[model samples]
Target: MIDLVCNVSNAVKAVDPKAKVYINIGGAVNLLYNDRLLGCIDGVLREELRSHPGPSGPEPQDPWETPAVLDTLAYSHSHGKTVLVGSRDRLKGARSLCVRAWSHGFIPVPQPAWTLGCSTPPRQFGAVAPQWLKATSKSIIRRPYTSIQYLSLFDIL
Candidate 1:
């Protein structure tokens, strides 16, 4: 997964060499926290397991351990910095971060597909040609890759 992300970042950088990229180093969120008891309970239970006699060592830590990242982004946006985030989780912190960025006048680009497209592969290479290149070149130079390419002689009443 890291390799894939690096490859994508490199590809983007190759196209635009001066692009500044910020990568998120956090993982998925199995627990959540809010301002109320429900929020505290989940994280508290996980922390408790770390000190308990468990076979699995310890539970995973929450990703939003540092609110500084959010604060920095908010600050940068307030001072006119363009921040682009590719967030994968839907935690309360993630929502709060988005709200903070918006409040500070930053344009947050959420990666909805990153959270939703769990089963799909990031990239697939065909035996003949790559799908994106094929689709794009055909659409731009030749013709659109249409349903008619597969469906033929199907005109009915």
Candidate 2:
């Protein structure tokens, strides 16, 4: 994960060396709520969306974290930075984050609803059948499943 963060930070630094990039280093949601860290971040890339269920099947963290994440989001937006929340569930926390981000002049980018593994193919709408359409469509359609699997595979690392 340090490598991943470094990669992203390095890429951003390469493009705009003055840009300050902050990475959250806990489980997905924990990273979402740390205001002190968020306060320093010029932009955020929230990579995972699901709340991890504890031994009892409820979230392991305090429920208050949700609001804290919102607070961090609001702060990021007020700073006029970009906040990209990547998640499998569009309705989970994405809607509120986007609404708040846009209200504060932050650019909000969301992952598509079919961003997680689902058996059904996504509906595609286009004016014409472009070259490599079939390959591109298949790749796009398979992304969620592939991504989920890829993330899971990293757990062993």
lDDT tens string, model 1, 1-157?
4344345446545765643333332322111111221211111101111112236543333354334444544444444334444333333234443454345454333334235231222222111222421332111113332221110112100
lDDT of 2 by residue, 1-157 (tens): 4445556556655765655554432345444345544444556555443354456543533577556665665666566545544443354655654554345544333345344221222223112222221232211122354321221213313
- The reply for model 1, stretches above 4 Å from the true place, is 1-64, 90-100, 113-157
- Candidate 1 minimal-lDDT segment of 10 residues: 41-50
How high is the lDDT of residue 87 in model 2? Answer: 42
- Lowest lDDT sum, 10 consecutive residues, model 2, at 118-127
| Quality of model 1 by C-alpha lDDT | 0.31
Q: Candidate 2: lDDT over CA atoms?
A: 0.44
Which RMSD values do the candidates have, in order? 18.6, 9.2
Score each candidate by Cα lDDT: 0.31, 0.44
